[model samples]
Target chain A: MDWISLILIPAIKSLILVIVLLTGFAYATWFERKLIGRFQQRIGPNRAWTFGLGHPIADALKMIFKEEIVPSYVDKILFVMAPGLAIVPALLIFAVVPVGPNITLFGREIPLVVADVNIGLLWVLAVAGVGVYGIILGGWASNNKYSLLGALRTSAQMLSYELPMGVLLIAILLTTALGTADGAGTLSLVQIVNMELPWYIRIWILLAFPLYFITMLAETSRKPFDFPETENELVAGFQTEYGSIKFALFYMTEYLHILGASGVAVSVFFGGWRGPFVEQAPILGVFYFAAKLIAMVFLFIWVSASVPRPRYDQLLRFCWTFLFPVSLVYLAITAAIVILL
Target chain B: MAVSDGIKGAVEIAKSMAVTLRALLAGPLTVQYPEQPIAIYPRFRARHELRRYGNGLERCIGCMLCEAACPTGAIHVEAAENDPEHPVSPGERYAKVWEVNLMRCIFCGDCETACPVEAVVLGHEYELAGYSRDDLLWTKERLLEPTRPNVIIRTE
Candidate 1:
């Protein structure tokens, strides 16, 4: 009975999460292309099935059939290993993300999350930063000048943005503490989400929300902050020499991280999986969480289409000089406010 | 920067976003060629076609007016006396061989303007891809659209 509750159920939940995330990543790529196309007043990729639904499937098939290329200049072992290293953390981070409340299954209750750890927030942030190691290793292993340069830029950007992202997240934790009586805050995402939030408003316009989003975009290495892979300068940067399935793995890791980060954001900032009829019907909680995720991913695509990539030096300077100091001060203010009031 | 400058920047960004959003809702403006082609403009010059009169007699009198007017030397005409049994033209002289090298044709509609009897005019069949160079050198028959024997129009 204990094994059934602890081991078997958790294993099943993890498997389900991996399957859901993989499908989401594939569909997210198609959704981004479609939205970007509409923004540019063009019908992008309408050939593959209806509304190009089979495009991701076709892309996967093409990737599988493509000839694998490993440059003689690259370190063989690390070059082969880097993609898996980069992709694993992205898959592992979702273990703590809950989509719905615990429900009875065969006379036993099972939590929706794979692992609802006490330090879920910290666990996510910690694992999220580990994906950069794969990028660094991949760049270093490639033995190309452009790859090394991309690695340097990525590490520096991660250093610059990750701090502010963490700090602002702490500020959000402080906000959550104010709504509680004991002045103690749980880092568990599900616990944080179950708490009462304030009235309807533009939460994104708030300082912490905007700061978190901007930093997360940089963290995801997406557009407007896509300096490492900026085609004009780096010529695909770290991924220049990689081809076939290895390159596909890197691409998959990226979209997975974006979706996972959005999940975290939805859980923390917005009341995740908490909406009308969600309490009575736990299945509806999953729908609410998904709807919010889609909205966030839509904004991600919209912003990418609307803006151009920033110059590398300018991006670093903005992060260090402006965002870093502002987020630090905001964190300090929130901590002080939480203590005094 | 001043607070007003920040506000102005936000407004400008939003305004540009609004324009793109409107365009998104307006739907795509693509004309899918060969599948769903757009209607060609009325005066658009395309492939050349030899005309025939209502009595089914060819209008070309073999006067060599079009051959003389063509700038690229695309038009070629040869004159011969009309046969008594099976006359091709109403005029005494008829064209024995008429050809237009489509590769050299600039679609200028000059031959149509030069003709006194409206015998030659550029028509609306624009899809002109061919595998070999000889296929592009349109002969008299290839240039003309097939005319039906009975009504020469679609039935109701």
Candidate 2:
């Protein structure tokens, strides 16, 4: 590949991806507030602009002017770097997620994804797994007991949930490999999105979908599973000491992760950008991708508003005793079916 | 039994989600206070005002009953004989100095009930925020005025 195609294209795609995700992050806050407000029969935020469209801009201005207070007792270097560390992995997960198929522009083919690595699914998981360190470091460096406790819960939660998540994903990969005509499956997210498996093969994913959904909610630290930031118990958790733009960065990382997780789920399960007339008009694929992403995000917000947060012990126990064994049994059943077929 | 319990738990969660969905469809009951003014109850007591007769004469007879009746001692009244040439009120005596310290007034309407001629009545203006102590101290001139400031006055 030429320098322009290899380096410049990827750089440009990265720039676009960053801008879109940040903007999406801003609007996601407004969206959640409005939707959740409706769930409780309250008008959310309609003061900034019509239906609070400019609320994110107003929020950004407020955060920008706030006093950036670093506590006197904190480990200064780690405290400052933790928010940055938390945000980078959240943004990196989307680098391999293909938004749409390749489009020819000026007689040159341009893929919609930033970096289409062969080990895309693994890269998504690896980058997502790295995000917990940011919380752990933030909690530890604060030198407060509550922060330490929150950090500990976060690490425990991530460890317990990631096991089932990984096992289920491996099962998916095995199914794709075995179900294919060539019997050769690729780990690339773009390829997985493009694959059209038979109905019998798709049945395995049906069994895995609800389990994967639960894992996704846990991975994002969203409500019903948001043990780390349990305000009633931890008083803002790991971010208790953070203030101003540093705090804003931590907040931004959360929304970005939500968008990233939804993007990965869309590409992996819902066929990325596949829609009616998508092959005929490739640009329409981006719209389809956006529509699916918004729907997925709506599901997250709905779950948050409807479900109550479980106790920390109950959450961990549910994972270890119930989810773990159930997934293991499902994995065994899948393996047996794959071999028998 | 455990498997059935898990299924039941999932069903309950789904039912709760359905309730929230129903709430989402039902539009918000919020009354936009600034742009859309809300109706005040007829019996609601707020800022104190001194009433007047249709002939443009003050109803207060400067009896000092309200001052004595005020539980918080928020009301201050001074009596002076009304000038025969230009009577401020229909009565022989009128209030020379009248002040109501709103910071102390609990809006219990004790002063309103104590008035002999129905002079001191609490108005419907509820927005009583003031920047300073003096601003909150409603004087005779301020109380006598037909319109009240610092409140969004609406007919409804």
Candidate 3:
């Protein structure tokens, strides 16, 4: 392919992916509200525009019109940069995600991905880690004691949970190696998922799925684990001082991260874009991807509504004493099994 | 004592779970709101609407009885001399400007009961959200009956 075509193709595909992801995020909020409302025996937004389809639009308009407040005590530069820092990495992480297999479009065989890097999984982890800087900066810049405390809690929580998360990834890697003839393994999600393995072997990996899922929830700062900005406790949390488009950016970043996290979880655990009948039609890869995404999103909402927030001390102890040790033991067991079997 | 406490705890958990499990099996409690509103009781106090006589004239008569009965002082009534060319009511005076500060009004239904002529009555509406505080305060023009048909009246 020519240089122009190469750049243009990827750029256009990335733009399309971003647009699709954002639209899904918008509806996800609506879905969460509706689902949570039902769970609580209350009606969600129903009067925005024609059965609340226009609720997001109404919300966007309201946010746009709102006065962007910057407190006098805040560090203006970092406060301004924080939301962008949060959102950019979230968008970037999806670049390496393989949505589908290669398809011939107008005689040109186009890969259904933006950029399939060799170390896609590690890249995702790294970018996700970087995304925490936004929260940290936001908390510190706000100049409120609550914001600072929340930020500190978030930093500690993210750091603590990450150890287990990384160890779990190590377990998946070992499984991938055992499935392969050679000891060398691929960290790419697509490659790992495409491995032709028996049910018995796959079952071992399946056991680790819940552990990874719980860690992902904590990593994304989702409900039950969402203590950083718990409305009842922290008022508005880190972005309490933010307003207007800036606040909107933070909101958008949150939904985007949710989408990214769900995508990663589906790719890693349930097998990415590999549908029951997807072998017949490769195009069904998109359908499988969307189904998995929706299922994961629903799980997030379910847990959010069902579970109560853990106390801060309890959260830390759960991470260190329970999760960390369990994941380490799991990693060791998987490694031992792979070596013996 | 520990054994008894364990039994009591199990029983309490069972009771709570029973309530939850029964609710799970039952039909969804979600009221679709705009699509399907809940059945309001007959005495449900909502926003106030001005009543009209058979001849299409108002029945207020500038009495201010409802205004006096409102404990929150939400009602504001201005009396004006009735003109024969454009008489608004049967009495010598009519309410020129009727306003209700809904923020202050407790929806006690006292105003409705106090009105002898039943001119001011609360209608069936509970939605009262607004972008600003000013939007909540109802003026006479907004509270009056619509001149056109099929007009959806908003009430608090």
- What are the lDDT scores of the predictions, listed in order? 0.83, 0.89, 0.81
Name the candidate, 1 or 2, with the larger lDDT value.
Answer: 2
- The C-alpha stretches of model 3 lying farther than 4 A from their native spots are B1-156
The superposed Cα distance between candidate 2 and the true structure at residue A36, in angstroms, equals 2.6
Best by lDDT: 2
lDDT of 1 by residue, B9-105 (tens): 5576567667777778988877665577556566666788898888888999888999999999999999999998899999888888889999999
**Candidate 2 i-RMS (Å)?**
1.8
Ranking by TM-score: 1, 2, 3
Q: Give the better candidate number (1 or 3) by lDDT.
A: 1
lDDT of 3: 0.81
Model 2, CA-based lDDT: 0.89
lDDT of 1 by residue, A168-251 (tens): 888878777655567587788988877764542125216477668889889989987886677888898788889999999999
Structure candidate 2, residue pairs in collision:
none
Candidate 1, residue A187: Cα displacement in angstroms equals 0.9
TM-score of chain B of each: 0.86, 0.90, 0.76
In candidate 3, position A205 carries an lDDT of: 81
Write one digit per residue (lDDT tens) for candidate 2, span B1-156: 255766787899899999999999997989988777676666788999998999999999999999999999999999999999999999999999999999999999989998989999998888889999999999999999996444443455
Descending-lDDT candidate ranking = 2, 1, 3
TM-score, chain B, predicted structure 3: 0.76
Q: Arrange candidates by DockQ, descending.
A: 2, 1, 3
